[model samples]
Target: MASSGQFAIVTGASTGIGLELARCCADEGFDLLIAADEPEIERAAASLRADGAKVEAVQADLSTSEGVEKLYAAAKGRPVDALLANAGRGLGHAFLDQDLADIRRLINTNVMGTVELIHKVGNQMRSRNAGRILITGSIAGFTPGSFQAVYNASKSFLNSFSFALREELKDTKITVTCLMPGATETDFFRRADMMDTKVGTEKKDDAGDVARQGFQAMMDGESDVVTGMKNKLQTTIANVMPAETLAKQHRKMAEPGTAKD
Candidate 1:
């Protein structure tokens, strides 16, 4: 049973910032439909339900159009109040050394599938002229990630796309807010095989705090947010720094075997 007719959808909600984002929605008394590629999504649903929110979990791979459709179908045409497109994968290595298949999947999951789902749900929101969208971009988008080339490129696409979409929909009640976070305490570094890199091993922001800030920004209809002072500074500098300089700076942080003791 839903505590409220209002509902929110969060992708990649099995863990990390995604799960925390779902929690934020639930805390706001919204029903939730959360998805992830892993079976752990069920556990995430259970946890939310324990807190009194009506929650549904769909274990769908969000890297393909078919998977995106599966999630969309689960909504059963309900007017979603909010859509948090947070599913994405990261890769860390020299661009040439990365496997082609991994690169393709990253692009598909981060870029293609996200836009596909947004297109479907966004049209629904536009029809009603009421809704919100929170895209999980990253500070990584602002920099040229040398060892993490493809992943950063994907974030960059999202950052640009979100702003453009927000401008296009400015006349509507629907709001599109991009959540650009810095590195956080998530499994992202481990999954990206970046444990040996300096950036991977460095201290990171808390996932819960990041998600809370993002959710609030979405509710407030803010155009975008960069979570921390350090990251804010990074973005400001990135705007002025030369591309080659940014790339080299990224290399120092992301290059393998660079982790400090």
Candidate 2:
């Protein structure tokens, strides 16, 4: 049986890499506080409980300040030993055609939501002078995205934020690691309405593999890591290649009208 003392909070834990990450944490014997926006959260939590890990499930729309606040309320006063601020959404379509409300929600959840939770929980961790944080980033942040413009931009913010955050917390023992994954097989593609695109259709890394790589990296205290060799090469090319070239390549894969219909 898993001990109930140490705890890790993971947002977006209903499915995909988040679900896998929660499971991985459970395997390592950490009790969990997992949140997701959907009703399936209860089901997911129930399964975790069955596995003998003490679990708390919170269903809140992470795209709003209220939602973030609620999750914080559930976690406040508990000495969170680790945090996985992984809740996020994806947007598809041309920038102009995108709905303003959806764009705002993406910004709220992907950037603001994560930031607020980190601030709340991170402060606690900092005060204790002990904790670990694993923020989920993506290869999408490495370059300009065509159809996934806003989604990519949000990730860019997260990537940059994580880097700066690591530096800010450098003197503290509270390690922050950013996990940048590329095209993983998850509900993210369908949820983002990108199932027809290259990233949504191509063979991709399994969520379990990506989660384990991220978990190990977080425990090892690596500041940032891309999950696969191919992805690492892509990040390398993205760094050295001209923006115009990279953007063009990205458009071929991400632009809804540019790729095959």
Candidate 3:
């Protein structure tokens, strides 16, 4: 069990990688406060409780400042020992063809809200001189997402932001680790409306494995991690490849109807 009185906050904990990360924290014996935009968050809390960890679930849209405050308010002034800022939304299609509201929501949830929560909790941790943060970025951030333009751009922001934050806190006890996972077995593809794309239809990494890799990296204070071997290779190649080439490759995988080819 983890040391008594440790508390962790995991966003997007109702499902997918977020849920798995919460479970890992619980297994380590940390009391948890998890949040998601959907009602399923309560169910996720119930399941975590069965594992003997103290769990609190909050259902709030993390896309707005009001919702972020609601989730933070649930912390009740406890010092967060670990934070997994994993809440994110995806949008897939030609950028211009996507709904304006969706694009704003995607930016708000993926960039604004995530950064705001980090700023809030991160300051508290800094004052206390201790904390660990694991942010879920994406391998997609390395390339230009032709169909998933906004989502990829948001992740690129996170990927860059995490590194800069880590450097800023280098002398402090706070550690910020970015977890970049490639296509994963999650509802992200379906929710993003990309199930008709080749990338969406391709084989994906297991959520459990990705979560474990991220959890372990954060614990070890690693700067960043790419979950799967294939993903790591892709990241390596992306760094050396021309930007236009990467964009073309992404278009082939993400363009609608490519899955049917």
- The per-prediction CA RMSD against the true structure, in angstroms, equals 1.1, 1.4, 1.1
Sum up the clashes in candidate 1: 0
TM-score, candidate number 2: 0.96
| Tens-place lDDT digits, model 3, residues 1-261 | 553688999999999999999999998889999999999999999999987889999999999999999999999999999999999999999999999999999999999999999999999999999999999999988999888999999999999999999999999999999999999999999999999999899999999999999999999999999988899899999999998899999999999998965
RMSD of 1: 1.1
Question: What TM-score does candidate 1 reach?
Answer: 0.98
List the pairs of residues colliding in candidate 3: none
lDDT of 1 by residue, 97-144 (tens): 999999999999999999999999999999999999999999999989
For model 2, the local distance difference test gives 0.89
CA displacement after TM-score superposition, residue 232 of candidate 1 (Å) = 0.4
> What local lDDT does model 1 show for residue 200?
96
Clashes of each: 0, 0, 0
The superposed Cα distance between candidate 3 and the true structure at residue 17, in angstroms, equals 0.2
Q: What does candidate 2's lDDT look like per residue over 6-65, in tens digits?
A: 889999999999999999899889989999999999999999888988899999988888
**lDDT winner between candidates 1 and 2:** 1
The lDDT leader among the candidates is: 1
The lDDT, on a scale of 0 to 1, for candidate 3 is 0.95
Candidate with better TM-score, 2 vs 3: 3
- Model 3 regions more than 4 Å off: 1-3
TM-score of each: 0.98, 0.96, 0.98
